[model samples]
Target: MAIMLYYPLIEPPRDVMYQGLLYWDMISTIVPDLADPDRESGWVRPSMMSPDMAAVADAGLYTPLSIASHVEPSVGIGGVDLTAKLRAALADLCSEMPERELKPRPAVEDPEQEIVYSDKLPPHCVDLLLENGLARVARREPMLIVSPAVHFTLLSVLARQLAHDLTAWQRVADRAEPCLPYTDQPWAFRLAHLPATGKPERCWQVELGGLLPVPDPSVPVSEVIAFRLKYNDERVRLVRAIRNLLRRLGGGEDPDEVFAELRAELADALSDLDRASQRRRVHWMRRSVSVLVALGSAAGAKVSPDYAWLLGLIGGYAVNVATTSMPSLPGDQGVDLSYLQRIRKAVE
Candidate 1:
């Protein structure tokens, strides 16, 4: 199963329909900070390893990195410089030494550094990202990153690097096909066609916008990835659903009313949704090369149904989608949005 990791932050609870409700087999709390260290490392300075290590943390990262803050007056005079004489002399001696058994221990790879990897994405990027509230957990399977949006160039860079890493895309590329998995084996079932291997990944990104928030009208659609919404209907519907659910659950805020209303309402809605889901039992369906599926409509086609252009209009390809069943109810972490999620799932 593909693990879903949110970038920047988790998707808004209200619109979990497109963000949380599809594709991934599991949800995770690991918030990956993709922010570049090159752009963010104001804390770094010279005396760093190499230019390529600009993203890497340097001794200067903490700034004025306390050499006893005064260096004990050095017994004579300790001048401030990029390199210390004792350390500089040691480097020369180490260079002359041979068959070194006393060498410093080899630096082991930290599990965290494995999260972001690309010749283009600097290794030190994670250093800054971590400093800025990024966290990490481990996953054995490939990840499907979900977020509202990222810079277009960043998205494309991620696509190029990660497309090959993701098992689904790798299988497709190795087979020279643009198809995605029809089964949830790796949890890549989607509503859009990804570009064939060696083709530009940006086109695939445009179609992926169908699962994200709708972008502003002033922005060119090609410049971003947003849900190909019908007048922002899905977003509006999600927001409305959340609001309604809150009003009903608000009764629980008052202990007196909780017993009177919350318990009864909860029992009823759960019962209703359980019955609805069992009756519907929606599963993945193969999509035509040129169609866009609406958020709630497992059947109706949206504005664009001809997405052959997404594959460069080259070879024909198919996309996969399913109203993936959420057997478990939303937990306390997302309890506020529980009712809306239940309502949306029940209807679908």
Candidate 2:
């Protein structure tokens, strides 16, 4: 018995579609064998694979005859046969095509530096996977189940929706002081695409009801900032508790009491930040102390290895969220924080 799951590769803002087309055009031209693995002759000119050519294709982009065939197989034991098939097809095509210089050769730095070739596809390949209509599949056996263009187009639509929500959330977090530092940290909640094996992984999945967990756009930026400050304060306290416990262990003493005391101290600190006239009171200095304490506690704990490991993981996430910098998009010049208060009326 065999089963298969399919996910489309391309979907929605038009820009992503264009980019994916450009990437595909480039690869199909430079590596024409990719398009027709069994071609006996006729090599494509690399110059013909420009962004303009991609645009033309985008304008007339019709669903490919077979989506399953276009989809690169997964890279593992399950895909072993597919991988061999693809390799053999490419080998046959390449044997009949004339070889040409693809790019400038790298200069040798040291005699011992062995020349190596990268098997990984170019970075732009991400444009294809992240764009609007590519289908993702889980298969037990190979089969032509869908049109490539149709799957890509469908998936692209979903991806665009996700991207829009993420962008809006990014806007809100940029205005919120507490979330700003954690924006770029891969572990913290933020939009990111991480490479896993040969595929792209959506690193940020924090969402509420299919949308980003953010306050209404109309809410005053000040209120959002205040909310984040309070939220961060709680995390700070947790970090402190962990640290105090570790510090006590360092002195060959039990950390239970120290953890309780540190929690109390954190409560006081949060109070001070809340009532303080200046926002600077809640800056990195106060947060760093709490983080350090948590780290210390994790190090000094004499508990079972599992407990210690759990403590370490929590403390680490806290520290990373507290100290990391905010992320910015490619075209983002800067955000207008004032817009936060001007957008729609506040919603609960």
Candidate 3:
């Protein structure tokens, strides 16, 4: 099969979504200090690589760098400039050297140059597989949906760290009860869409779960050749919410009663916000609240009760905006109030 290798951040308008989600956010968050593969020498030491790809590297090729702060020397002689001498001597020697055994390494000049290639596909990279044929790239938002075959490849490629963690988790669970294989579990199946017929499909989710043995061994060497190709910011505003609920659930504070009571209060506040006279304002308020609930829910919170807070916030804001006819103003009437309201309601 001819593998489609799409370069991230290179295709301009067509690649914007990939760049935004994978390059700008995922890559940066996961590895903040290193240069992206797009730049020369933009290497992330294999040892320091994300929990997944560490084993893929040859043993000695990857190593971490050390960083530390130091006070300037108080009385050192600061007059030696070694650049001119070093360059001239190296250049003469390099020019005389035969180009048989070794190639000279490039000189370091710009510190900001990047280097961007990796062995496996990251989440956003797999999205490109949705563009199976050249013809599909022209379709509207093809990357937005993908095939089960592609998803399997994607999930299988996620950081092996996640697999290792799951495996360890399973060991404990197994002790409690004999663990069933992923294929036997109902929730382990993922939904995919078949091409041509455009029908929904189901398949076993990628096997990312398992407990790793101590001193995590390298991934089997055979797996690397089998694969064809490759390759958030938010702050909490509510101090009390963290203190009363997250802290307790996270194992810092007190009992369940207090957390439950606070939840009820937050819901009432949301309800009050939703009842505002301006439907647009209420909708806007709810949308904002919904985002919070979604985030909290993703973190394992009970989002139903908190849904009110989001509803109230989005609704109150939407109604206020509608009542003022702000979005309908002369120059800036492009805002989609109805769309915003629907989003807000979804969270509620």
Candidate 4:
């Protein structure tokens, strides 16, 4: 059966902030009559009043002006000190609010995981998968479903790490397109299915295939393209090595040794990318490998959540890198010249 993992999109807090600001501004505007000394001279006291008299006249209001005296009020208008009437109004306003409105609203529901059937696949997605050798439609049974959460996590890490460079960030976005369709939505992949052995219970397994080559001639030969091709090739090699090492870990290989080798390879790749002036790719590679290494250490003990996540991430990256770097199809003409001519005609 296919397994699906769904993460709900959450709205930002700006709406709540705007609501609060609007309430505060409205209250401030409506209460000015109580705080403005010019509007009500009694709300403010005479500034020239003796200290003893000022202390004796200590009311909730700021400073009370004597009608016979023309002394300035010690406390200025619109100060923190509020008249009894204004304070009562504020208390009433606060009391009018429900208790539930004072506290923060509960957070949205957490992400979910579930088992599903192969028939649930969208027609377009299934057709694309069949055309790309990702699935076989002849088999009417459901395959093991795998989540794309790891790939999404890696993309997030890459995006954040390389945000400073616009060109580099764009490259990362371009490279992420292959897995975007699956990862961007709440969907899963047909990892593998159990063979029918006529036993009481059949054993199902999960597996990911290596990269598939594509043809795209639209990309002209350039330093940037060359760098991308080389980087992707190196990444494929690293992914294969990681998969092999993870497998060996189950067979009692030394975790420390395997991790050390992986770290060294990752470092070398990062260095090479930096030398090639591929800053964005380098940032992504560095962050991805660092996280993988951290998570890989714990995975050696047993198959943990982190290990599964790392596998999905690396697997998705490997597949996307291979597919995204392919040259554009030769027969695919670019923007229609006729359309441009029509625009020019309209302009004339």
TM-score of predicted structure 3: 0.22
- In model 1, the number of clashes is 5
lDDT of each: 0.24, 0.25, 0.21, 0.24
- Which structure is stronger by lDDT: 1 or 2? 2
What's the lDDT of the predicted structure labeled candidate 4? 0.24
- The sequence of per-residue lDDT tens digits that candidate 4 reaches over residues 162-204 is 1112223224556321111011221111110001100111111
Question: What is candidate 1's CA lDDT for residue 258?
Answer: 30
- Model 2 score (lDDT): 0.25
> What TM-score does each of the candidates earn?
0.21, 0.21, 0.22, 0.22
Candidate 4 all-Cα RMSD = 30.7
Q: Per-residue lDDT for 1-348 in model 3, tens only?
A: 000111111111211112112111111111212445674332455454433334322322122211100001111012211122222222332354443211211432221111211122232332333232201122232222322222222222121112222233434555321111111111111110112111111111111011000111232322321110111111011223322332333231222343455555444433432332132221121111100000111223322221111111211222111011110101111111110112112222
lDDT of 3 at 86: 21
TM-score of 2: 0.21
How does candidate 1 score on lDDT? Answer: 0.24
Write the number of the candidate with greater TM-score, choosing between 2 and 3: 3
lDDT of 1 at 274: 32
- In candidate 4, which residue ranges exceed 4 Å CA deviation? 1-227, 230-233, 277-348
